[model samples]
Target: MTDPCGACGARGCEELFHGLLALDHSRAEPWGPLHGVSVSCFLLQHPARLPADGGAAARGLLRAYLDGGLPAVDRLIGRARAANSHRVTGRSAPGGAVPPGREAPRGGFAVTVEEVAQDGTFPAAGFPDRVRAWAAATLEVWGPVSP
Candidate 1:
């Protein structure tokens, strides 16, 4: 079998993703406000799952949430939608050095999908709180944003 996921060290990463998807779908109302931050946190931890432009966007959104909470994140998403561009591209320095604020963390996150799963499934009353905690913990592990 392939090695465990580098980010979360989870052997069944795909299953975890599917479980998250199910949670999102079944708990749309509760998950709505936290969706962007949740996805951003997950993507930041699992960098390989993100596309080239996605990394920067995910980091931007996560930083926005941490710095200004949901309102700030809403503003950013609004601006992107208004511009008809949701993707945020990263810029590299002269010698191919990645610009600050553009780099994703290089190791496993402090919180993993496994930990979230321990809080129970989507139908469980505490699932939403668990997810919120997961996002917060993940962001905390990444530390402060460079920019």
Candidate 2:
């Protein structure tokens, strides 16, 4: 088998991803608002899986959700979709480079998919709470986004 993911140290990321997808489809209601959170956290951890624009967008979306809840996240997503851009506004400066002040941490996040999975498998009771905590903790490691 392949080694664990370098970023998140997940042993079986593909399986985890599949589980996440199942949870997303099976528990859409509770998972809807928090889906972005989970996605952002995963993308941020596995930065190589994302391009520069995607990384910035993930950071921006996660920050917005932390600061303004669902409405803020929705607004950012709406704007990106409307503009046909893959970035979250204010997350990337021009040309898809992450702004200096908003860069991800040099090492890694304190929390990751492992922690989220610690609560149990996806679609299990209280899984949403684990994801919420993972998002919050991961964002905490990234610190506050600069304006």
lDDT of 1 by residue, 1-147 (tens): 647787767556667767777766664666557677767767767877776664667667766776677798888888777666445454321111124555656555656666666633544556556666666776666565444
Model 2 TM-score is 0.72
User: Which 10 successive residues of model 1 have the least lDDT summed?
Assistant: 90-99
lDDT (tens digit, per residue) of candidate 2 on 1-147: 657777777666667866776677664766655777788788767666766464667777777776777788888888777666565354332123244656545435566676677633665567667776777776666655555
Question: Where is model 2 more than 4 Å wrong at Cα?
Answer: 1-4, 85-107
Worst-scoring 10-residue span by lDDT in model 2: 88-97
Q: What C-alpha lDDT values do all the predictions have?
A: 0.63, 0.66
TM-score, every prediction: 0.67, 0.72
